[model samples]
Target: MPWLATAVTTVGLLSTGAAHADTFVPLPGGEISRTLGDGTVVTVRLVGESATISPSMGATPVHRNAWVSGRAEVQVAGGIKKGSIQPGYVVGCQVDIAGGGVDGGASGKTDWEGNASGGLTSGGNLSLGPGEATSFVILDRESANDYGDESHSSANSFKGSEASVTWADSTIGLSGCAGYAQARAFVKVKVQTETIRTVVTLWGQPFSLG
Candidate 1:
C-alpha cells in the first residue's frame, strides 16, 4: 500500500510539470541573436528593468504612481547591401513593453499599457500616458535611411548597431497599482533583404506590482 501511494504521487508531480513545460517563460534581462540570409546579424539585449513610485505628471506631490523603465542595447553587424538598383534594406532594432496594472488611488482602477517603445526609429520611446507617447533616443542612427517610400521616413530608423536606449513611462506604473508587465526587444527594417528577414523577438521577465 505504501509503495502504491508513492507511485501515485510521482505520477501527479510529473503531470503538473509537463503542463508547465511548454509555457513561454520570459527572461528579466537577456540577449537574443539572429543571422539573416544575405549575411546580417542582429542582437538585442536588455540590461535591466525597474519600477518606482513617482509624482503624477500633471497632479501635485499628493499623487503617486508607478514609473516603469528599462535599458535596451543592440549589436548589429553585416546588415547592408547597397547597390545602384536592386532592393536594399535599412535594418535596426526597437524596444517595446506590454503590461497592465491597477491603481489604488482616484486614478483609473485598471491600467493597460501596450506597444510603448520607439520602434526602430528615433532610437526608442518612453512611456506616455495611455494613448500619447514620446520618442526617446537610445542608440542614435548614423543617418536617416530613405527607401523612396512616402508613408515611411527616417524618424523610425535605428540603422546602426552598438546603440543604447533608456525609456521611462509614468502612466505604466504601480505606485498605486499592481498587476503584470512585460518587456520586449526586437529588430526592424524597412524591407526584408535576402539576409535580415527572420522573426527576431526576445522577451524580458514579467513584473508584478504589489
Candidate 2:
C-alpha cells in the first residue's frame, strides 16, 4: 500500500489546481468476478475513480485535456498463486463507448514483453479524428531486463491472493477532434493456478471528456 499512499499525496497536489478552468467529475468505479474453467475465481475492481477536465491549452474546440486517477484491485481464489494486473483507458472521439468495448483494434491490452509498447505514449497524448478511438496502459514502469539492459512494462505482476495498483493525476490529452470525446477505464487481471490460467476484465463507467 505504499504506492497507494504516494498516489494519494500526488492526488492532493493535483487537486489544488481546481481553481482554474477545470471541471471535476466523479466516476462510479465498478467490479467484476469471473470463474475459470478450473473453478478458480478472479475478481477485479476499479475504485476512487475521477477525472479533472480542463480547457484545451490551444484554446480551440479540437483540443481537450484531462487528469484521471484510480485504483485497480485484484483478488484470486481457488488456489491461484500468481497473476498480473494491467490498468488502462479507452478514449473515443465523437463515438459511443458507453456500451463497453471498442472494435477495429481499438481494444487491446499492453504486452508484457518488456520492450513492447502500446499505441498511446506514456504521457497519454493522442490525436484522433471523428469516430476514432484508442486504448493505452497508464503505467510506464522501467527496470533492467535479464541482460541488464533497460526495459519497460505497463503491467505489475503479483503473487498470492490479492494485489492492487493505484495511479493519480495521469494525463489524457487529445487534439484534432472537433466533436465530443469520452473515455473509460479498464482493469485486466490474468490469474494462474498450477494447471489453469484465466483472464478477467473489469470496465469502469464511461464519462465525457469535453
Best by lDDT: 2
Tens-digit lDDT track of model 2 for 104-196: 112333453213444434456889899988877776678888999877666678777788888988888899999999999988777878898
Output the lDDT of residue 155, model 2: 69
lDDT of 1 at 208: 28
Report the C-alpha lDDT of model 1 over 1-210, residue by residue, as the tens digit: 011000000011111243223122233666777776666776766654544433343244222234344555555576443201000011111212342121111111111111112343332222323232222222222332376533312212233344444544323321211122232332232223444444344445543222
Candidate 2's TM-score: 0.85
Candidate number of the best TM-score:
2
lDDT at position 207, candidate 1: 38
Clashing pairs in 2: none
TM-score of each: 0.39, 0.85
lDDT of each: 0.33, 0.75
